[model samples]
Target: MLLSDQAGQTAATKIPRPATLRESVIEAIQELIVSGQLKPGQHLVESELAELLGVSRQPVREALQQLSGEGWVDLHPGQGAFVHVPTVEEADQLLAVRALLETESARLAALHAGEDGVRRLRALCARGIAAVESDDVEAAVATNSELHAVVTALSGNQVLAELASQVARRVRWYHTPVARRRGMDSWQEHTALIDAIEAGDEDRAAQIMREHTEHTRASYMEQRGSQPVEPAPKPVRRRRPRTSPTD
Candidate 1:
């Protein structure tokens, strides 16, 4: 309980354990889902995933169970595992909560961000803009997240930053699908947010954050409604041979 006792503890306590197979498998599967390689409602076959991931089925199976518990995957009694399909309402609600948390984060960031913090934001915004210009959706999405993270951290509120960090990962997943569509406009919005923060305009920063999150939510809604239903494959007809002509 005392400083002397704490000093007696070896650095060995700080060394982290290596990831177990199951833990690694879970992370891999989560990456696949987050990258959109595993589409929503797509079947997750243990054997196939094991082969793809170069692990045994046991770890894959365990990973699926853990993911299902986390609401990232769905496990059906007869159907095995499938990626969770987020609903319109779910996306809207999640983004709404994100907006609430981040709007305040931006407000505090404006009040607390130093010149160095503003510089970091500007650098990230430049990267984001370049990514959009090059049509690299993935890179743009990553930079966008990094820029927001800087703003959150600059808020000088540890609790709010932590909450934003937790939501940010899920937000990245949802953002990936819409990144290409959001494109230049998203970066331009970032530009505005950075300006507000640099000017120490707390009200304007908060308003920009709210509108930015709202735009993403609206984009998700539009994307959800616009998903095209695939037409069923038609059966090929075989023509009967003319027996008389063949003879």
Candidate 2:
């Protein structure tokens, strides 16, 4: 009878484990950043974020530290955390890296992608175009990112997928603004890339991807202007004013 009671209790009483505070806080913060609710250079007040996430300051602090390590946040020594803003030079570097990685990914995808992969890529491109047509810049950016991610996954290389995902996160910083300006043309480029992939032309796919990334970098630079120029020093005043007073 004791054994029967023990079994009944074991079956009825489920173990209740609490969610990890750090993970919960991290996910909440990440979602806010990704959705553009917490923009670049925005101050991350620990107490405020903790309140919003329904978590303690400890978890929010740890999450911010982790995000800072991931290059998503900037942790000032005394001022606290803020979202990281990528400089024009940093954006250029990220685009270059993406061009290299994604070109190879596209090449591999072209060689390995079957009809199913092609269909998925087409659907992603269509979604991007529809988003742009609807004037949904954020949706367009998200769909575009998803398309590239799908291409990388089709490559069937886990390491490549990880690298592309990292690059894509950084690229998202530039993509949001660019998509707002570029609109449907961005999706048109996606169409060309997918067409190359569907044709099973590895070389063409790589070439197109490289050119697309370079064009995006150039457009971003053009939008932001060139590097900062130091202001010229003030010229010395003539002695005529003092001479007039003396005269």
Candidate 3:
């Protein structure tokens, strides 16, 4: 049955998806960033991005705004949008938060994970390890994220999982640089963590996860410390022009 709104627009059984084009463009840009195709601090040209993505400038503009809100892109007024470059402090703080949340998640996962969940984790671990072995940095990073996501899901805590999901991409951003360096060791730790969870050792699982996350945090800090920090340009706010009184 169709219903009419105050605007006299007919509402059928279905409604058009809101901001579908903008959302798709947002995902595409995020993928480019996460995969390192769009390097940090690289300028994002709206027209070029629109042409590349086969979308219009309007959607690209909207997507850049959304990405900026999410910290994936920085929009500088009068200048343009650029990919966000992670600071050492940002990486440390974010990873610290991740460790806290993931530790508890590991405890819950151990308490809640079933055999199928354990099997799935093992499969993800294998894929990550294989990616590292092949020196496929992008694949390794992606699989690493998947492995952590699965662990969070296994926790069976809806709220915790949601929070993890929110920060997962940012975490991926920081992990990209260290993927190759941390690869084998990271996956080995995943194996140990999975064993702990599979054995239902909550304490062990939490401890392992805490240590594993700390390792990544330390790696990021060390690596980023050596690199020069470039401050992101802030957007200039335009002021309204003053007018004289009319005669």
Each model's TM-score, in the order given? 0.84, 0.78, 0.85
RMSD of each: 8.8, 11.1, 5.9
Off by over 4 Å in 2: 1-19, 226-247
Better of 1 and 3 by TM-score: 3
Instruction: Name the best candidate (by lDDT).
Output: 3
Q: Rank the candidates by lDDT, best first.
A: 3, 1, 2
Q: Kindly report which residue stretches of model 3 are placed more than 4 angstroms away from their true locations once superposed.
A: 1-19, 232-247
- What tens digits encode model 3's per-residue C-alpha lDDT throughout 1-247? 3343433665346666676888989999998998878988888999999999998999999999998998888888788999988777777789999999999999999999999999999999888888988899988998899989999999999999999998898888888988887969999899999999999999999999999999998888877778665756676788999998999
Per-residue accuracy of model 2 over 101-143 as CA lDDT, tens digit each: 9999999999999999999999989888889889987888888
Predicted structure 2: lDDT: 0.82
Q: How does model 1 fare in lDDT?
A: 0.88
- Find the 10 residues in a row with the least total lDDT in model 3: 1-10
List lDDT for all candidates, in order: 0.88, 0.82, 0.89
